[model samples]
Target: MTSAIPRITRRLVALLCLVAAPAAFADIVIGQVAPFTGPQAVTGKAMRAGAKLWLDEVNARGGIRGQKIKYVFRDDAQKPEETVRLVKEMIEQENPAAMIGTVGTSNLEALKQDGVLEKTRVSMFGAVSGATSIITARNMYPVKASYREEVERLFKQLGEMGRTKVGVVYQDDGLGRDALAGAQASAKTYGITLVAQSGYARNTTEVSNAVAEMVKQAPDVIFLAATTAAAIEFTSRYQAAGGRAGLFGMSIIDVQALLTKLGPDRARGFAFSVVLPTDDRQDREVVREYLRLRQNSKDTELSSRSLEGFIAARALTKAIERTASPTAANITETMDRGFETDVGGHRLTFGKGQTPSRYVDFAVLGNGGRLVR
Candidate 1:
């Protein structure tokens, strides 16, 4: 009788609390996996902040069909094994309608191999990779230009700028391999011989040897196929040694963040391929909206990476709004309908015989760390 009386009292308290909770948004949820506590944590934080900014605005507008957007996040630390386990755990337990912000190619590939994507029916949205995973998977979506496109455009852009001798410093991994494939094709097409090429293991700061090799060939533009941090280290050492290569980086390289790390002396005069327009670009209403939202953010500092995250979240939200409920099937169908959507001038449309975005832009860092458009 004593136990029964206490249980009855607990039930009454739960009912009262439920009655008091907000009802306007209490159903929708987004799940994310990222390198929140690793070498990539800086970028992970930026991406999360950007996603939260858009989500907060959406919820303030009463959410999608009055269902509040709740986010569940797990840190993969950019490891493939950990990513596989965590993704499996979420699919079996969390019941998220769609998974967004999963970082790295291996992480996403691990999830697909675990068979959790189909088992849970949780579509992947706005993942960080522009590799083959995006197009090969039935439910995954890409927000940035592919490495292939980035490399090809880099060659064309360099050619346009009258730069023929290109050198590549790439990390030895899937990311680098994909980038190299594209660069080789571009070199063949452009009829330009690669001035020099070298590969280093990921996370290694010992690039003096590679830098020396590249300096001998005197590449007009040094295309970086390495990770962001690795690229910074190489560029820093290379430039300090009086290497005059026009330091070029891929879309995956965060040029702004790289500048912040290297300071004005090392970062100035560097150019990088980007998938999004510059922050100051205001020709598109979508661009203006992003600037406004970013200005209203608490951090006030934004990067191309963060802006891409914002655009991706905003794009997915539009698709979710078309669904009757936050179910994977409904979300997938809505997204596949090929509806024209402008993500701050990064247009995304996919329907019968259509595809997702493949736009590429360019930016160069000038004196005092200013991004010269």
Candidate 2:
């Protein structure tokens, strides 16, 4: 009962507190459209908490240039069409100065295809996708390393450890397609054999066939390029079938959530590639600050997704600080003019010919569900 309380608080705060700007309060407004209720809800919730924590802190300190920021978040339920609709509605009604924390490669692609970002000219930061389409889309800036980078890094490590026979489990969406391509490329580069591969439907955990396929291959390692829910389901089902492949996943797997659901026994030894420095990096001022704020808040768990949200918020705030009178156009222009800044120790630079940040760390689930470097 007590554990459920924090979950309820997070849900309420995510849905109500940032749903829309009060009509009376007028100031800086930023909006987001993401999955709040669906398979991806866990990712959405962590992102909301991390971004909101920084934004709330900014407001508590009297806001930027004495103007309070209004963060408006809407739910898309992990549907691409709904993402297009809700983002359009938010832009028309709220007139957000910018956008932040958009999730999913397909959702971002839907927005791009509909010209929502280009037409509205609102700069969006911290898009939770490493898909090439999103990275190249005009007015969309990604803060993390590309999915290709994450896959290649993992493959390189596997190659070093002489784990050459590998299989893949990915979603059949833009995110999955991008990652699968990366996996193929990385396998070729690392001299790892692509023994077998399987893909599940988007936004669903129906991975029985996929799991069966992987079990048959019995590769030395299986790379999971999937969402959190799908990853959890696959891990549970695969292990139950007596499959013994070394489970490795991309950053979207949400290590903290995995620990909670699968427990230490089943979840142990699974490795993950994280885009940000792990929580133990006390050397990073941003990591320290995030830890402090999380400990002080009602949020139940801390994960890379949450840290990603906070970092995205910090980057957007830095741009807002430089603009004369923050608006969609000026913020877009300010960010387009080669925006670069350091969030504590992690550095991000954006402009023409700029590659996304290339920082990734690997960790494995140790005893008691803690990450071991």
RMSD (CA, Å), each prediction = 5.1, 10.6
- Model 1 misplacement above 4 A: 1-25, 203-206, 300-302, 336-338, 351-355
**Strongest candidate by lDDT:** 2
Tens-place lDDT digits, model 2, residues 1-373: 9999999999998777556634324589989898989999988878888899999999999998778998889999989999999989999999999998888999999989999888888988888899888888888877888898899999999999999999999999999999999999999999999898899999999999989999998999999999999999999999999999999999988888888899998999999998886678899999999889888888763466799889989989998888887889988888778777998889998864365599988999998887788
lDDT of 1 by residue, 1-373 (tens): 7879989999999888878864443667788878888666656666777787788888889888778888788888888788878877776677677888877776777777777776666777777777755555666776766788778888887777778888898877667777888899999888767878889875455577779989888888888887677888898889888899788887777777788889987798888887766567788776787778887777743566777677778888978877776777678777655587776667886543234667887888999988786
Worst 10 residues of 2 by lDDT: 17-26
Q: In model 2, what are the clashing residue pairs, if there are any?
A: none
User: For this target, which candidate reaches the highest TM-score against the unseen true structure?
Assistant: 2
Q: How many residue pairs clash in all the candidates, one count each?
A: 2, 0
lDDT of 1 at 231: 84
* Candidate 1 to truth, TM: 0.87
